[model samples]
Structure formats: structure tokens, C-alpha cells
Target: MTRVVLALDSFKGSITASAAAEAVRDGWLSQRAGDDVVLRPMADGGEGTLDAFAAAIAGARRRPVTVTGPDDAATDAAWLLLPDGTGVVELSSTSGIEVLGGQLRPWDAGTVGFGEAIAAALAGGAQRLVLGIGSSASTDGGVGALTALGARFADADGAPVAPGLRGVASAASVDLAGLRALPPGGALVLSDVSNPLCGPRGAAAVFGPQKGLDAAGVVAADAALARLAALVADAAGPAHPGPATPGAGAAGGTGFALLAWGAALVPGSAEVAELIGLDAAVAGADLVITGEGSYDDQSAAGKVPAFVAQAAAAAGVATALVAGRIAADADVSAFTAARSLTDLAGSAEASLADPARWLRAAGTALSRTV
Candidate 1:
């Protein structure tokens, strides 16, 4: 009997991470009658992050807090904490694009409440802070987050600006006197994006459209980010690598803000992998399988499958990817092999109609080759 580790991301609108993992297991079991399999579902700090983390940590409490949503509307979001004083905050929980009810305008969104969430975690005496920077609907260059944490952003006239992306562009100066109030330790920001804070390939241009911003809006948002960057540089002395780094453009510029706040930037998949002991599991397994909802050129940009493939390759383990749909340009050759559930089901509609059945069937088919 062969031992296998099944780690996969959620199939987006079709299946949850756990379900996908189960489907993979079912496939393996069907083909290999006496196989030992371990299922570890993963999320990239986006829509399913809360569910994924909840699954990962046993006995973690889900606590709700009120934060500003994408539309400047008051909404309640939740975070997780363990008895050991480890706290987790997902940026999307407060300012995610999904929470906006389909009206995703980055200019109007704010990270203010995200900062408040951090404050709450600090007040609760959390020893470790894991900040997930994914699925944000804001493009305020983190001004809102900074403001919530006690930093003051003032215009040239010295009056405080409203907290949002609009205000970030007008920021002429910043006051960081509030840093004294932060918890007495470091923070880790888990981000899955690799875009910088400014320029053509920056956050605004790369992600603004997804948040309902037009080309003009993207340009404005970019300018706002540039201005905010200047303000941050004035206060923090210098910009950090993670904010200006390639992967920093994720989550509507939230990555830039986290970097400015001294949060350590770790690959989101890699962080989750470490928590679930994925490397160890892969090493002990005869085969490894991982995937996401969509496998495209962007998947190479720090997505779950890419990270898993990298790990498996380093460990000399054979790996396969199973996605709901595989992009035409995706480098499938990068993995030991890759396939889509859609291929076996004939069409997307058919596969989605009964995802579990298709997933299991697809997994079984792949198991024979392994």
C-alpha cells in the first residue's frame, strides 16, 4: 500500500478546501485499495481563509468584531485566537471585496478597521499575530489601517484627512506617535500577492480593475499609492523590500501597508504549509497532490499549487495538480503532471454540477498512473 498526502486549495465557487481534499482521498482509495492518505486542506488567505485556519487550529475561538467594509459601510467580521495567545487576523474579513455586495470601488474602501482588529489583538495580549493579507477591497495604500492604529495623516493644511484611498493621495505628512501603543512584539503578515506598491506593475494597475476601478481609477489609485509611499518614507525613514517587492501588490495595496508596519512577509502558501507540516508529509509520501480552483499564469505567482510543487520538487517527490480549470498558458510541465477536473467531466457545468463526484473520479484516474 502506498502512502499519499493530499493538500489542495478550495475549488472557489465549486468546492471547499476540505471537500476537495476528501474528493482527492476518495479517488486515491478507489484506485489504491490499501493506501494511507493524509488530507490537509489549504487556503491562500482569501475568501476561505477563516475556514481553512479554523480547520488547521484545534480549539481556536472565532471572535467577531465590527469593521468598515468595502463600501464604507459598517460590517462585522471575525478573527481567530488560541488559548496559547496566538491571534490571527484576515484583512478580507474587514475590507474584502466580497463583503462589498459586488460594488468594489477601491477608492472608497478603507483599512481602518483592519488596524482596529490589530489593536484588539494587541489589547488581548496575543503573543503572536498572523495577519492574512488577501481578498481586500480597499486601495487606500494602508492609510486607513495606519489611522486606526493611531497614526495621523494630515493634508498640507495640517488637517486630518478622511480615512480611505482618496485621503491617501492628499497626505502631506504622517505622524507615527501611535507606535508606542502597539503590542510589544513582532507581527507576521501572510500575503499571497507579489506586486509592488507603485509603477506599471504595481497594485493599482494590476488589481484595481477587479475591484471595479476603471483605467482612470487605476491611474488615480496608483498616484495615491505613490503619495502614500512618500508619506510613509518620511515617517518610517525608508521603504521596506516587501512593500516595494514584486509580490507586494496583493490585496489592493494592503501588503504595502503591512510591510510598512514592520510585519514580516512570508509566502501565504508556505506559511500554511509549515503550520500543517506539509513538507514533512510530502517527504514521507509516495506521491503528493495539490491544487487550486483555477490554474493560470497567475498561479505561478505564489499560489498554493506553485508552492506545493516547489516543495515536492525539492524533496524529490512526484507531484500532480488537479484544478477545476486549467488556463491555456499555465506551465503544466512545471509539475510532475497536471490535469483538470473539467477534462474528465466533459464541461465546466457538468463538473460543477457534482464536483465531489467529478473530483473523486478525476483523482482515481490520476492515481492509476502514479
Candidate 2:
């Protein structure tokens, strides 16, 4: 009987993280009866972040508030209040691209609502803040968020501009006087990306297309971000280490904003794992399995599975991965082995429509070797 820990991210468009974990458990149990298993669903500060954190802290309160969406629409979003008084804010709940429906434009999205949510959590007496910066639809470099928090981004005319990366280019001044001072302990922003806010390989070039930006849009967005960066440097003195670090381009440069506002940039998966006590869970496990929807060259660039694999490796535990699909001949050195659910299920549509069946099958196959 092997003690196994199943930690998987959401399959995206197919299954939730919890369902994916359960599928693995059921599949593994079918092969090895009474095997010790622990299920820990995971996220990279993106779509499933709130759910994963809520599940980790069972029965937590999800407080809803109105925030600006990707299309500048008033939309509902939530923040979690745990029993321990730590407030968890997932930006996607407010400014996610998925909430846009058919209207997807990075130039128009904003992070103002995210700042409002933070303020709401503070008013509710939250002592610590854990902000997850992923799955955003804005490229304002967090200018909109700051505006929501009382920091103003004004044009040369001294009038406020609409939120999004487009506003960044015209930004000539920033006012931070109105921001509510953080409590004595301050806040911690948990970002999943390391890309800088500006430059060729920065936010716009890497993430603009994902938000429906064309080549021209990318170029414009990049220029806008460069202008915003210059403004930040003028205001804050210099670009911080974590903001300019790799993976900081996440959530359309929200990571840069966090750094500017004095948030620490720990590894997103590592921070989540620490919060959920994954090290303790791994110590008692014989094998650990983790994965996401896709595995490719980018997985090495701070994706969830790679983080889990690193943690498992640190614990001297063997790890395996099961994704919906694996990039052809991708580097799997991060895990002991890797497999694709699509390979066993025969087709992507079949696998997505009936993920439970395929996940179980894939788990069973991996269990034989583990």
C-alpha cells in the first residue's frame, strides 16, 4: 500500500481542480485498494485560485462586491475571509478575461475592481492579505488598481483616463495620496508570472495576444507599458527586483504593481503549497502526482505542475504528472514521469466531455508503475 498525494490544477474547460483530484483518487483506489491518498487541488493564482484556497480553508466566507470587469462593465467578484482572519483576493473574480463573454479587449480592461475588493477586505478587519494575480484581462500595469485604491493616473489635461493598458501610454502623472494605508503588518501579493512590465519580452509581447490583441495591438500595448514604466520610475525611484524579475509579467503586469506597492514576490505555487501545509502532507506520502491542462516548454517558466514537482523533489518523493495533453517531446525532467489523458481517452473532445473516465484511466495506468 503506497501513500500517495494527488495535487492537480484545474483541467480548464473540462474539470475543476477538486474534481480532477477526486478522479485521480478514484482511479488510483480502483487499482490499489486502501492506498493512503491525500487530495490537494492546486492553482497558479489564476482561474481556480479562489476555489482552491476556499477548499483548503473549508467553510470560508466568500464576500461578494461589485467591480469593473474586462469590458468596463460593473460585475460581481468575491474575496475570501478565512477563520484565521486572512483575506484571500483572487483578481480573476473581478477582471478576468473569461467574464468578458464575447467582448475581449486588453486595451479596455481594468484592475480598479481588484483594488476595491482589497479595500473592502481591509474594512472588514482582515489582518493579512493574500492577493492572487492571475487570469486578469487588463494590461494597465495595475494603474487601474491603484486608481481604485485612491492613486490617480491623470493625462496631460489632468483628467482621469479609462482603465487598461491603453491609458498607460497617456499617463503623465500618478497620485498616491488617497490610498488607505495598509495595517501595521501590510499585505502580501502572490504572483504567478515573472515577466517585466515593459520591453520586447515584457507584458504586452508575451500576454497581449491572449487578451485578443493583434500584432498592432501588441506593439501599441508595449509602447504604452514602456511609458507607464517610465512614470513608475519617476515616482518610485527605480524598478524593483521582483517586478523586473522573470514571471512578473503575469496578470498583465499586476505583479509589477504589487512590487511597487511593497508586496513580496514569492513563487506562486510554493506560497500556496506552504499555505496549505503541502510539505507536511508530502512527508507521509510514498508518491506525489500533480499536473495542469497543458505541459510544454513554458511549464519550466513557473507553471503550477513544475512548482509541485519541485516541492515533491525537495521532499525526496517521486512525482508523476497527468495532463489533458502533453506537448510533443516536452521536457519531463521536472517529474518522475508524465502522461496525457487524451492519449488514453483517444480524443480531446471525448476526454473533455467525460474527464472523470479518462482521468481515472490515466491515474490507474500511472499507479501501476508507482
Which digits, one per residue and each the tens of the lDDT, describe model 2 over residues 1-370? Answer: 7899998888865788889999988998998888998988888877788898887777699988887777777888889998878888888778776777647876778888888888889888888888888778878888888777777789999989767876887888876657667655667776666677767768888878878889998898888777776676567565455446665577888887766676666667877787688888988888999988877766766778888888888889999999999988678977777879888888887887898899899889988876
* Predicted candidate 1, C-alpha RMSD: 2.6
Candidate 2 lDDT: 0.80
Q: Can you tell me which runs of candidate 2 are displaced by over 4 Å? A: 238-243
lDDT of 1: 0.79
The TM-scores, one per candidate, come to 0.89, 0.91
Query: Candidate 1: misplaced stretches above 4 Å?
Result: 156-163, 239-243, 342-354, 368-370
The residue pairs that clash in candidate 1, if any, are 193-247, 194-246, 194-247, 195-246, 195-247, 195-248, 195-249
Q: What RMSD, rounded to one decimal, does every model reach?
A: 2.6, 2.3
- On a 0 to 100 scale, what is the lDDT of residue 105 in model 1? 66
Best by TM-score: 2
Best by lDDT: 2
